[model samples]
Target: MLIEGFIDTVRPSRNYSEDSVGRESVHPDQLDQLVRQLRIQRNDDARCEVKACTSDLGSAVWDSVSAFANTSGGMLLLGLDQESGFAPAPGFNLDRVRDQFVDGIGDGGSPGRLVKPPSYAIERGEVDGAPVLLVEVAENDLGSKPCYVRAKGVQGGSFKRVDDKDIKLSASEIFEMQVALTSQDTDRRPVSEAEIDDLDDALVEALLDRRKGSKALRGAKGRAEQLSRLNVTTKDGIVRLAGLLVVGRYPQQFLPRLLIDVTVHPANEKSAPGEPVRFIDREQCEGPLAEAIDQAVSVTARNLRTYSTVEGTARVDHLEIPREVLREAIANAAVHREYHQLFQGQPVTVDVYPNRVVVTNPGGLWGGKTLESLDDGISRCRNQTLMQLLQSVPVADTAGVTVEGQGGGIKMMIHEMEAHALDRPRFRISPDQVVVELRRHGAEIPALRAWLGGLSTDPLSDYDDAALLVAKREGKVGVTDLRDLLRLDSDDIRQLLSDLSNRGLLRFIGGESYELWSDEPRLRTSDEQVIAALSAESPLDIHELSAAVGKSPNTLRPILRRLIGDGHVTPTAPATSRSRKYLRTR
Candidate 1:
């Protein structure tokens, strides 16, 4: 009674306005800026389109709407002349164009309705004192994509944006959009052709022993019952794809493409003079998922350069790329890649390069995960059963440890790289594939070393070498570019660039961009060097030619074969001749 006027809680006040309505307005200033940009470019771009709507709302507007909605959102500028340097259309009737656009989008009886629902905003603005309409199309939700033109129908009308043009979606592309709408169950489906005998008995036994404590398998009567409980096999004794992949004698025999294709490329094939045209080493890792992971890791490791150091008379061999990091990447690919029929044709690829190792798997980040959110302890697997099976399967060489269990592989990778003073791994996720790149730190290649040598003698910062390398690779880099690559703040990026500039390593071009200022001599490509050596000295045997080009005979063999095939060079002897010699076909 004494505190009758006191309120313990307060409700937030709500404000509703035209701007806060179902569709918000794109600000006039922003629209103005977009128009200015369109004028400067004199053409439409990926995110902005201009149309002259002085007469009527053209049907082409809906095509842009469908394309923009399917892809990332984009803007439409009506009453702008795209053909006339993006100038405002003369005699633009804002009222007439706005009415036509509204009726075309909203009126069910009208001929220009969108086939599906998508978020959008509409506003009116003036460009160069000429009336115009700004319509911003929002990207549709993932589950409800492929928005199309109603008149042409979904299949005939749906389009995707490529560069500045809207291209029609193929049937396969439409199928992929629908596939992403549902949770994946492809791994759990029974392989009707595969029987219980197809599975490897020893692997199955070990997996059961590893999963002995799992409540799901507790009190199971026999191996059949346990496998059924684990979703590894059907009641009829038919093995599931997951079962075959995890424990089959050789999964690739049944599923040919379910394997890893590993390749070791030459260091700077484009720039390293006399580098071979073919791979240094390549292997197809085929077997059960567990065995394939092991094989992939081993094949990649053997191809990498090793640095040996003596510590108290004991030599420690360190791989250019850490072994643990490599294994983790392969394991993740095997456990997480999509097993759907759409992607079964695409095998996992592990490409080892001079300065980095790239591992790619079909299927992008699933369960609504983003690159920024990967290390936030949120793990989502497309193949839950496959992941569980891998978690129960122990590594062949390591004792008392599963391939992967805690979903902490990314964290472990980060820690391992940091401990070794290496750059953290980078990820690239697309709609159909996910790629992980592990770059070697302080493993300076010849091109990078040459560029750094031209700089001042002063010691550079920790990330200076990496940043300069990026600049050299990309031609020019700005603060934002360095920020994304180095994960540094804007202020820190400015400081780094300024320091590099003071050291005469980089020069400020306009607009926060810096061009690398090095006068190092440009080196000829490997192919060029080989061609030049052959021109100078004709009819050289493989070993002599290898000496002249400074490339190993094993590496030079492929280049010579390629040149002969290309009709650039001719061999003096038969295919099996040990004394074969090569000369230019001049």
Candidate 2:
């Protein structure tokens, strides 16, 4: 036995428990009250990991902790024998085992020192009557990462959590991390060899003219002062990476990887394959970021096909997809792409399909951002200097929008697409790139556009447009039905629905999960017809009831379920059948 009793090296903050047992997460109220709920089947899933009782404390366990700290935050539970259904290890010494475990892991743990500037919080807690030491490892800051075992050094010592195991980070991964941590952005470095002549005077003048009266460029006397104020000119009076990339005569000459390449693919969703070439046409846009963004958007818009849709009677013509949506997406790929990293001959790529458009750039979502959280509008810019340089540059077509770096462009893209009733934009992070796709939904897009054009002066977010779409088609919507609508999570669904209700755009029953909405409430959503058809003994299925309600069965399910839940009707005997009938209870 290692020892007995307990020694907590790092006390976990209150309420870290995933079980939602109570207000407190530490020290379960009762030993048995764990509810036997700790599930540890996978070797090492996203968060929880189970270590065997007889396992060596130094190597595998500490490596796992370092990997967790360096990747997403994870849990390390010791004293659980995974081979035996992960029950508590027999004869596990609480204090002695914890001491061994804690000794090898911290911000700077042991000879290998997995975590640096260490801050791995450890807690001694019980689960199913077992002494398990919970090592809670949070992902280190981007500036403090690539936490590696000191003995192995950064290249070999660093470990990252893949699917379930701690895999050693590749040399490239380590280099990237080291570069990212040590140099948050390499764009601030001035090119000593480059001179004032390297930067294009026209580009500088254009930028200055665009921001003439703006406070961003106030009191600037000359090009040097202007560049100095923007922090693009170093103390040596040489152009930095930011100034060169944004206004230099040839940014690609200075940094070959700094350009935008857009390709127009020629396939729709359901189509035969073409010659396997990436696109039917291609263009390499090589200017500063703003001009490149504009060129890319212009070429992409030119190659796409258009269609006409009649809204109530007025015919509105648009690209198969919205132009502004594509513009915004392309702008995003250009403005936020990493300039220092090797593009491997691939610059930003915007692939256009007959029915879709995808804008891709060289870099994953930076600083620990996941795809699911991108829509929340939390942004971490990879090129801080580049982003700041565009502060005075207005987005080409967006009147009040500029490269303000507020992260609103993403939301705007989603909103515009949602309003047009086109497909929702999908953002994904692959190993080496970030992709944003805007796909067209066949012919439904025409109707979607018309429906959108009919709205008043109000600007609808992606969520509102989605709720309206559901309401228009079905006459009713529920919180659960709108899960795929906006970025707000389940906790905020009620607030969203209530906000819509207060705006008179929707109406919901008190505390009910469903909301009532309609363009024509009487003809489309009136439930009286549904109620009238029911009697004391006669019930009807959705298909049969749809005729009486004058609404589609698919759209009537919520109204029917709500009516039933409130005792307005009762099901026939032998309930729960697919063809079940109902009776009026009231």
Clashes of 2: 5
Model 2 C-alpha lDDT per residue in residues 1-586, reported as the tens digit of each score:
1011111324334223324222233455422222143442324465666676564564666677668767876766677777666677887765565556555553124443454734545565677766566656666766677787766777777787876778887654565565543336567878777788888777677667777787767887876887777767886688888888777788777667667777776566323455555458889888677777778878988886666545554665677667778777877777666655455356888877776777888755566666777767777777788777776555455544336677677777776675555567887764356888888765676667567546634555556666777777776767766655554577677777777787777776545444554554332235566677878876787788877767897787777777776667677755457877777785
For model 1, the superposed segments whose C-alpha errors exceed 4 Å read 1-33, 90-92, 107-112, 151-156, 169-176, 179-181, 267-278, 308-314, 400-405, 442-586
Which residue pairs does candidate 2 place in steric collision? 107-115, 107-118, 112-149, 112-150, 539-582
Question: TM-score of every model?
Answer: 0.67, 0.62
lDDT of 1 at 325: 90
Could you list the CA RMSD of all candidates, in the order they appear? 19.7, 10.1
Reference-based lDDT, residue 3, model 2: 11
Angstrom error of the Cα, residue 583, model 2: value is 9.4
By TM-score, the best candidate is: 1
What C-alpha lDDT does candidate 2 achieve relative to the native structure?
A: 0.66
lDDT of 1 by residue, 108-186 (tens): 2454478664566566667777767766677787777778888888788888777779888775566656666468888
